[model samples]
Target: MQTKDHKVLVANRGEIAIRIVQACRKLGLAFTCVYTAEDAASGHVRIARELGGDKSLYRVSSYHDANELMAVADDAGATAVHPGYGFFAEDYRFARRVSQRDRKLIFIGPSWRVIRELGDKINTKRLARSLGVPTVPGSDRPIYDEMEAEKVAQSLFEFQEQQGIRKPLVLVKASAGGGGMGIEEVYDIDLFRSVYRRIRNYALRQFKDEGVLIEQRIRDFNHLEVQVVSDRSGRNPVHFGTRNCSIQSTGLQKRIEIAPGFDPSSIEYGFDAAQVLRDITQHSLAMARKVGYDNVGTWEWIVTRDGRPFLMEVNTRIQVENGVSATIARVRGQKGVDIIAEQIRIGLGEPLGYGQEDITFEGVGIEYRLIAEDPDNRFTPWVGRVDGFGWPERPWLAMHTHVPSDDPYDIPTEFDPNLALAIIWGKDLAEARERGVEFLDTLVLEGANNAGEPLRSNVRFLRDNTGRILKF
Candidate 1:
């Protein structure tokens, strides 16, 4: 199939939408984009108009409405749909609708079956265990009975004690819940039942499922992720590398991400950092190959202080931090690696064309998620108008944002206040940290809310965490 013959409907907004449109352009594929009324001033809409004319953009009531998206795709003659990161990116039902619709359109992530299979935490844990992959010490399946749940919780506490963990903790969470909902920490096993009951009740009411998962809560661990890519064949999959996402907000939301996971070249570690990266990547690939994973996805892992790594979950779509990994990756000894373009190509039924040995890593890369939030105050979202947003142009720096610099843009409260993503590359960790600090210090992002207060951003927060990057 000719790439030029296909058109993609960008079913998302903000920086990801802009990147997808850019990827489509790079791949010689036509594309259309959607925007809400609040997002009319977004840079994505402007880019679509400049590159694709009036027919390339459509207005929707909400990003969550699948019917509206389908209508827009049909009206715009889109042959495929690209759900960038959030929203419908991992939704199996949405993917199924796109594939099984009367006028079928391609779902540009993975097949619905693959998403459904891997989307479930229980199923993923079972599959990983079957493949001898390490997972958190907990129940592999949802525990519906209170006795079973308590037993699992007790075993987890005992297991932590046996491991010589100080102040051991257990986590009770709704198996069907995500995004930090229906979860509670039990520092004392005596209070476990109450917390468990509360979470179960909440889950039953909110998610309509009372099943709960009990696991040993591992604290002070370095959060790492393995980036994997494959074609539709699913027989051959290759990993880009690992990324360290330990720098995060109090809410556990990642603020900065560094590629290559750990850098023994610049930073010292208590464990074998290189071997740990290898273990996680090999385990991730093993599971992907077992399940025939067919597109770009991320395997989230938590590495304990003593070098123990456990699989957390899998993100079956392109993530916000993908560019950081790409920044340090080289395919066939060439730079300029674009993971989004690769995902689109494979999603369109094209072969991967390259093997794992063909890909290599270069230098350290850091990605700072610049957001309009007050990091000092629990990362509260600041609603305001961005009057000025600009940064210096450096050969080693790449910035991705939907906030336009030429005009004043309002910070929409309907979604996340992410302003831009600054990705920087250096010869090593020292240079990368220096350049990261410089970029944050010189960045010009000025704005004010409706009350006339000055713009408050996480720039200071990002700068303070520069010294702590990849330090596990």
Candidate 2:
């Protein structure tokens, strides 16, 4: 109903930003990007402009400087700002600044008001509970002191006992935390004070909000999420299948598989995996509709071994693994599935143009994050000039990274650690698993190491973890 020709400013960096740049080009929208001076030579900086993107504004330096970004948007005559996850993506203040009274710049996530409510964990949990969304068993109130934390821990343990879960998994985590930050687990009651103090300090320092909550951490839980897209009208919100990010270790996401995962083993659990998927997808759509959610966001959940799924939180922005959704849509024969482009269109007052009945997915998609780190030697960062790099010459296999070029040896590195992402699709999980191995085997990262000892990359780890990528 409210459609306008829009120009967008990508307010982040790295692969996620590049994804947006590609989407803007495909949709024929004028685009701009902000970058730190350190990233002046980055691949995104070059590619975005090549796709008819605006040149960088010489004035803005800091990526997190909301004022400077606002100035850039004004100077570039951009109509919308898409904050790729991290930095100011979830920052409510940045949202408020972008949608301030004067400038008509659209913030391409949630409204600033919704962000204010859901960005804080306590408020989000309360809202989710009110909407009948299943949440973890824990205290409704924020745990502030030792007494409060201990009391909450006891209640959580009691709940765990009732649920027949045997793991001292009482967690005190930051209310305003994401990207695996501001979290601590308590295994011992006597050590509660120390853990509480440490977590509280970290939360205050990192999130600038000491708000913490206690939750019963689901043991052997699988991380899952449903991707949803909405328009300004809010009548046509659609779910773009689901993704399993359980292939993570030590709280870092290493690999992700979409559309019911590549694990046939998970189907052996007591409850039906189909039931779990149905429940999560239904709950996610219900929650988004309840809020009249606009733009694109993800509904994150944690499912136990028994296939019981509980809502974790809503990421109110474009996610890094959104590529999986797009690829899955394509594999299912749904063309033109650019989520970032839709987010911009919704922000600019366009209807979703379709309803849930119009969407479909029938295949598996997996994304392997190519960390510029060694799989052996404790996953140490191995970043430097890439002597040579290559991948399998397959159109079905999609890769997002700064590592390859017309000249394989021309690959440059800024040593930012996360180097690339490889995405592949298959008609089923088995086919998906096989293609993953093929992709990894074909990957050729033959550069001398930064330490000059040996070449290092996660391709080996991914290849080795073939059948067991879910547990990682």
Model 1 local distance difference test score: 0.92
lDDT of 1 by residue, 265-378 (tens): 878899999999999999999999999999999999999999999999999999999999999999999999999999999999999999999999999999999999999998
Per residue, candidate 2 scores C-alpha lDDT tens digits across 1-472 of 2344677888887788788778777667777887776776666777765665445433357877887777888888888888988878877888887888498688888888767666766677877888787787676656667687888888777777787766666887776665555667788777877888888888888667776788878778788889988887765678888888876535454455565542454435556776777788888888778777777889889988767778888888888888787777742456647777777777777767777777777667788887766656656567565666777678678888854454433223433467688888877777888998888877877666546765567777777766765442
TM-score of each: 0.93, 0.89
Off by over 4 Å in 2: 1-4, 53-59, 139-147, 174-177, 203-213, 261-269, 330-333, 374-380, 404-416, 448-450, 469-472
RMSD to truth, every model: 2.5, 3.3
Best by TM-score: 1
TM-score of 1: 0.93
